[model samples]
Target chain A: MPQQVTRLLIVFAVFIGMFLVAAAFLKPASFGEYGHYRGNAIKEIAAKEIKFVDRKSCANCHNDNSDALAGAEHALINCQTCHGPGYKHNQWFEQNKSRFMRQDPASGIWTVDTILVRAAKDIPEEYKLLKPNERDACLKCHAINAARREKVVRQIDVTDHYDVKKKCVECHPPHAPNS
Target chain B: MDPNYQHLYDALSKVEGYIYPNEIGLNWGILIVLYPYITGLVAGAFILASLNRVFKVKALRPIYEISLLTSFSFLCVATMPLIAHLGQPLRFYEMMITPHLTSAMAIFAFVYLWYLMAVLLLEIWFDYRKDMVIWSGEKKGVLRLIYKVLTLGVYDTSPKSVAVDERLGYIITVVGIPSAFLLHGYVGFIFGSLKANPWWSSVIMPVVFLFSAMVSGIALVLFIYMIISWIRKQKLDMKCLDSIGKFLFYILIFDFVLELLDTVHRVYTAEESFDIISILMTKLFFTLTIGQLLLGTFIPLLVLGYFQFSKPKDAIRKASYFIISILVLGGIFCMRWNVVIGGQLFSKSFMGFTTYKARLLGAEGLLSSIVIMIIPCLILAALLWLLPPWKKKNMEAY
Candidate 1:
């Protein structure tokens, strides 16, 4: 190669060097360990804070609600589906449980491990989580549409079924709707 | 309503039949159309430049350097649309950093770099090395400094060295022809390889794209050459323009035939996807039938073919060529639009059709595309200033 060609080659070589440097630094640490994706990402995702705990956790406090939900048409649905992620409630209640409840001195040596929260107003607005009523949660799955197949989801024609102003919960208590 | 989703909401009202819920908005909009269109121009311009160096076509020599510059300038701006269309434009380098080899889309980054750096850049540099050395001394101020730096400290302009430069540049041009084909043909293949879309998937797609690319690239260079010469008040080289028209006419015929063959094949077989594709054709009638086929391809063939039989007046020839170039250029753009947008208009279900209303503003909109198209012209203007391809200037420099 001529001196000029050699100089051009040097420029190309420098570019190759830059790309290699970029590859070394910019590439995710766990990339290509198992395949094209970051292998460690799976572990990282697994380690993330839970936003939806098991229904068993919700069942621990609301025995009557759980019993109603289990015996009703909404047996398959979990508390978190309508109430939003229960993990946030668990965290907020654990931190602010003192405002909601305290161990009774009358109970003496046999004190309960956890207190049940009942009052809706005592919870802070930020930690209130979701308490969907009427159309908000029910209409999401039941709204009549051409694409929403009958077998996949039961469609409700909101206009024809009843007065448009009437709440669905008035006729059908979501926890025990079939009753 | 959120401005981002307004188009989708509007499209929802126009939705016909049973398209998927996800198919409401066109993901690959006008920017994607411009992407292949621009790349085709770059590859086509390079091929036209190759006609001078590799094929030893004497008539093409006048526009040869300009062709290369046009290729270089457009090639530089080619990936702008693809990058800007990205949702996370900042992370776009991830395609380069950890490019998935199996992906046709990811592979474009390498292909683009190879064409720009190895083929076009190297060829242009070698061609201009001796010129840079001479002009470095002949000029002053920033341009002098620019030329001097461009020379890369090699001041040797011996007959042997100049001979070497020409020989090497010739070799690069020969190498560049296939790379140019690969550059644009690969684009065609990207669309063709998608088996899901009956409109796009065809073996003949790559060939059609390559020929159309050549047609468009040649037309663009021809248009630029005429415009620049007219602007400078230089007498237009009728022979060069005539040769361009002739080449353009031939290749465009091939391009049309290949496209027709694909369409005819689809029609003849009338496979499972035939009905929806037929509907797609009707939907794209204005752009496909009028713009690309009638105005862009057929008329250029008629006029340019007429030129071959008899010598028209120089003024008439020039005006006809200018009009033909514009028509051909616009036609190729419509061709890309049809392929990219037309393929998506109909659903994979072979049932429904969706509408695509191109946004007037925003990143992937018509305005952005027009702005991107202008950038290449601006770059070409800058390049023409720095590397004057005027025969008068070349003689003056020598």
Candidate 2:
């Protein structure tokens, strides 16, 4: 081999060696352990507490609202789907449970304060609740458009059905929108 | 709804057409616009280099070395915008290590690496190795040490070895031509393959991108060459400038025609997306019509066309070329802006539109783009000082 070619080979080999060494150290610990991506990512995600309060939790306290929604158009929809996550609201209730309970004098029974529990409207800012009657919250599902299938649900063109500025809940209540 | 909720209702009222709730925010911003623009320059500069080295265009010889260096300088920063735009820039290397073949994005890392390592770096090294060896011997101090390291211990500058180097460099240029096309064409493919976007999903996207790359690349070289010559107190190469202008004119026409054809087809077909697309064109009337087509393309075309047919004074010709090159560059940037941002402007539902407002600061903002743009010029200056691509008396010693 020519002297220059030998030198070139040596330089190329050094570069390759450097790259391999760097790659060995810099690669993620769980990378390629199972598949191409970081295997630890699945566990990292699984470790997070569920943030959205399930429908059953909301229904346990608001049976009237749940019953109103049961046979309505949004029967399958989760409470947090539109109202936003309720994990913090549940946490707040747990922290202040004593304030929301008292002895009923007539029945001589200890009862939960329905007024404090039912007023989900006044949840703390951390709960990130969607304000009731907000057009965006309702339009997210109810806004009529050509994109949604005709058979899926009756879609309404906001302008054609009523004034563009009017909210869907103005005429139709959310729990029983059809009524 | 209660009257108290009117504030929220008013905010939602800004949306004029049907847009996917997710599409309301324009995900790709000015940074995405800069990605293709920077990459196009790289491809363009490389193609210009190939014209001189492989095609042996004698008039273009003056720019061959400079163009190669320009391509290298820009290539170094080409992926900066992309990496910065990523949510997790630290994991950018993951694309290289475990590429998903099914995704178009997965291919970018491989393509960028192949072009940078196999094509550009190798070609530049072969071209400059002899010079480095000579400079190492002639100079002293830090510069000498740097050149010595660059030589990689290949001190031989024999006629036979130089001939072999030339042969290898020529082969790389030949290979680089298509690689240049692939580099920018792949950018187009990234957009073109999106069946969901009517504006981007065109068969001629790669062709349009390739020709426009040529147009902008040629114009940039001509512009830079003129500026550099003036700064050095050297006479402008009128023949070279004229030839570049001629090439730019022809390629601009082809690029314009391809875009026009795509528009015409969309109009004639009048698909479900046509109405929305027409609205988009109207919304982009200033950018697509005035900035890109009229000012960027047509006016430059007419000026260059006149210059081609009639003999003008050297000063007048030089001034015209400089101004026209700037316009063409701006026009090409507008084309890229239209493709990247315009494609995302309208909702996938083909019913609504959103606006992109670039910030002066922040990660993907105007400030960052301005900084990104300046980085290449700085790299070019450094590369020029280190290698000095221009012919100097000391280079003859090799």
The candidate that achieves the highest lDDT relative to the unseen native structure: 1
lDDT of 2 by residue, B45-79 (tens): 89988977888887777777788888999999999
Point to the candidate with the largest DockQ: 1
Give the lDDT of residue B352 in candidate 2: 81
Candidate 2: Cα lDDT at B342: 85
- Give the per-residue lDDT of model 2 (tens digit) for A1-179: 65555776787789879877877777778987788778999999999987877787777567788999999987877888777788777777777677778788899897667676776465567854565686656765555543355577666654466776777788888888877
- The deviation in Å at residue A59 for candidate 2 is 3.7
**Residue A92's lDDT in candidate 2:** 75
Against the true structure, candidate 1 has what lDDT? 0.86
Give the alpha carbon lDDT tens digit for every residue of B102-121 in model 1.
99999999999999988998
TM-score of each: 0.89, 0.84
Error of 2 at A11 (Å): 3.3
Candidate 1 i-RMS (Å)? 3.3
